[model samples]
Target chain A: MKPKSFAYVRPDSVEEAVDLLAQHGEDARIIAGGQSLMAMLNLRLVEPSILVDISQLKELSEIGVRDGAVEVGASVTQARLLAWPELKARAPFIALALPWVGHFQTRNRGTVCGSIAHADPSSELPLSLRLLGGEVVLRSKKGSRKVKAEAFQQGLLTTARRPDELITAVRFPVGVGAEGAGFREVARRHGDFAIVAVGAVKVAGSIRVAVGGVADRPGLLELPAGGSEAERRQAIEDFAWELGGYDDIHASARYRRDLVRRLAPIIISEAA
Target chain B: MRRIERDEIVSVSFELNGKRAAGTAQPRTLLSDFLRQTLGATGTHVGCEHGVCGCCTVMIDGVACRSCLTLAVQVEGRRVETVESLAGDEDRLNALQRAFNKHHALQCGFCTPGILMSFTDYLGRNPKPSEDEVREVLGGHICRCTGYAGLVAAVLDAAREMRGETEPEGEPHAA
Candidate 1:
């Protein structure tokens, strides 16, 4: 399972990194923390002609909070986010979900923006981004654009980011009174990729729920304006039906729908 | 910021077992292979050659990470502590290793190095971890021999030894 031969480069600045990516386009792949990319590389699942290692870019490693928004840089590791007290104070749900992202070791090097960039269907980072109302900043030599989490994640293992674009950072608006938030996922093992995961938080005054691994991308369901607990749960069940699921070796579409139907209310209630 | 051509060999220098170790590896070579084949530090075994197995766990710059997932060239100027560093100059077993023997924490012995390295790193920060905390740390690893009962005991025992506690009693899983 050795990887194919590939050229390697480490750009010192974000601009230079983007320039290199623009020069290579689809032939180049960016490696930030190298947690997920290295595994894929070892398995030969992806073979880029040029490998751009961005782990050394100092500009992308700093975590900043401005205008009441937490901006996680592309090189910010998952462990680094968990270490920041502001993250827990600003968004408790993200803090709760970080521990489940991976094991202690992988978290030490796995980047939050890298997880978002990878766009795994069952990942907790993407679900947290969507439920908390986050934005992904994509940059290229052409210019830059901010895409919401809902739109940035295009499909399973796919994103709205172009080949030449570099995800400079991702910003999640601080939770206003985001207390009592909760996250849970059912995985075969603690560190294994989740079969189905749910993330919920109190945004403004309403409880927003996002379900992962049930469809091509994590979906944010619209709750009724006002209803009893049972009625809201029924709406969630119906919403689960609208989310498209497919049969795979891990779970059947029907089973996944049931999981969403059962998991949504529990997590939403916990967030309350 | 050095750029290399395709399949170019690069020299990687890192602190291994508190000493400088230098070797040459292609960009694709994993740190686990570099330690075993290049440096002859086979104590870091590769069970799955993937991140899940945890058999290749080591201390990189004081943080425990799976060597298989880390590229060899990535360890440039980094400090690495393998299982070989656990023993003293006289080759005496460390407290954790001694506890594992007393508690029957290992049978196949393939998963011991990773578990020891992981617990060694964990116990350093948390000298007195509770059972649930230990289990949470252990959850990151997989052992097919069903030796968890003994493994958990070894961790708690090692923690007690580190904390300088009195004669310790093993948990229900203790051998």
Candidate 2:
């Protein structure tokens, strides 16, 4: 399948990019790496009249610590982030999961912020951001606003970002003292989308388990750290039931729930 | 922000296989089609335009990426290396290609170009990759024939040859 022909523009600055967005509104789409957006376009799933390319914006390519988190800009590709020397110290879970985002080929061209912008329910970046308490920085001609990952991701393939907004960056908070995080997923193949993915982070005697690929959106559940093995298993099982997995071609509702029940504890225990 | 109209044809210029190349394309033309249809470099095959099949893989600025997922204009002024770049000195097969021939890595030869391009990039960065690491990278491609056993052997063999190590006993020399 070929994409429907569309106008293309490469803006030199973030302001110009947002200006283009405000000018075109719903008719224009912002493209960073064009890894996911181009695939959607090739499938003809999206037919915007124009595409604003922002991969060349130098202002949006920073990967430095800001406030208390590592702010990844829109132009920071997945391969770039993984190559950052401080990635393991700043965000170990992301480092562990980045290799699973795609193959070496796609990761070279896929941006970390682009994945958050896409907000796929089964994607590793979204689930990791949600569990680690991150924020998405959105900009437009009007102004800028920061939305937490929980509120930013509305539902399946939907986000709180407006048509005129450009996701300039996403902030993943730096790991605090002695905080341990772990991520695991079961997919049909290593590089394929996960059938069920689980992530866990332990801090100050509490553990948070996040589940993806089994719900309309990635979701998180919290439980105390010192519970008995059986108690922890029961709590995870109840949380799995609450998620209410549905049948799909890849996995059944019951099977997804079972994976959650099985995977949550292992991840939590590993994090602990 | 100057926009190219949907129907406007623009000259997309890039360095292909160590030479300057230029082609005209619409804004939506994929790099794979631009290379094949416009530049006549058909070694880069397109199996699935959506980036899953990994058949359209090529190198941009020394990194492997799916040309089908990249627009022709996006690679403007960039250096692109397709399967055509692998051969050397009167079109002799490269070390990886020789290993693949020794190991019988391909039965249909459709996915070989992408796989060879990937290995070229991979071996440059990691000259001593383990078998599992080779398989991990090879997993990105989907090959129906040869069952991947030969592919794994070829990659490991190629890695040894690139590392300048002597061949083991009774191992056939990769031409």
Candidate 3:
């Protein structure tokens, strides 16, 4: 289906794009890769008056190491991020969940920040980022601020981002100590959005489990390191209660809650 | 809503088949529709408009993208090559296309173009992808027919043919 008519602006610089977005305010949308926004537009979910095309903004489509952390530009495509050697070594959880993203063709145009901004509860990237304690860098004409992934996503398809702001980059802390990561999700079909997805990271002798698709937003649980099996089981059960799963066409709320109770311990055990 | 006037359609210029081309497109027009309906390049098909099905896949600046999910105007000044441009004007099928035919990889041929474009781009990057890598890359596509065994074999066969390990035989000519 065709999308509603809108004005298009291809901004060559990030500053120009930011200015355009600020001018358009809520009526404007920044499109990078256009993988998600295009689908939404065609579905008429978002009918913005102006589409600020930031694909040409070279400054926003980069991946590099800075201060011992892998900093990925917001426009960095999922395909490129998976192929990035640094992400594999520095942020292994991101690497593991990259393949589960929508098939190869979609990943070619889907951006890392775009996924986070879209804030799909079932999306692997956002849950992985949250588990890794990633921070999103938001910029606007006024100033720039950083928000942790945990606090960034407020609800399903919701974020802390303002209408005029743009997500410039996402930063992942490097260095590993007792840190292992595992990602598991169940979907009706390969490449389909997950019915339930879990990402776990063992760091600093503690295990962090983030559950997606089963809640309004990704739910995270932090367990004390070197815990007994009984303690781990209790933690998993408690985490399930905290998750408060919701029912959808993919799975029932009860089913999701049960899966979390079952999957969290498994992921945590593997990561531990 | 107000009617969209003709002047509202913007002229988007891009490189198609290595030649510069321009077209008037509305903001809502998808690249796949623009190619097939507007430019008469039927090689790119629309399977799932949501980008799940790769049937509308095309090489945009060497990366496989679902054209049905890409806005035509967004690709201005970029390079786009559909199946029509995979082979040169000489009418010779590309090695991947030939391998697909040689291995009988397609049954209904509905998802062939998208698969071909995706695998072509995959092999371009990793010329000798292992069976597991082939599965990993091809997992992005969904083909109900052929059970995907022949598709995987076709990709492997194409890799071998590209490396001069095998000769093309009884290749299915594009219909």
DockQ of each: 0.67, 0.80, 0.43
- What would the per-residue lDDT of candidate 1 be over residues A75-170, giving only the tens digit for each residue? 999988998978778877888899999887788788999999999989999988888788999999999999998899999889999999999999
True contacts kept of 3: 0.51
B-chain TM-score, candidate 3: 0.89
Off by over 4 Å in 3: A176-178, B1-7, B170-175
Point out the worst 10-residue segment of candidate 1 chain A by lDDT: A221-230
Preferred candidate (DockQ higher): 1 or 2: 2
Question: Candidate 2's residue-wise lDDT over B33-142, tens digit each?
Answer: 99999999999999989988888899999999899999999999999999999988677787788889888999998998999988888899889998888888887898
Arrange candidates by lDDT, descending: 2, 1, 3
Note the residue pairs that clash in candidate 3: none
> Across residues A1-272, which tens digit of lDDT does each residue of candidate 3 receive?
67887877777788888888788799988888777788888778998888887766788878988876678897789999999877667777777888998877788889988888899989988887788777899999999999988889999798999998999998877743236877888888768888889888888768888999887888888888788989888878887877888877778888988888787777877788
Against the unseen true structure, what C-alpha lDDT does each candidate score? 0.85, 0.89, 0.83
Better by DockQ, candidate 3 or 1: 1
* Candidate order (DockQ): 2, 1, 3
* Candidate 1 C-alpha lDDT tens digits along B122-165: 89888999998888778768788755999999889888887878
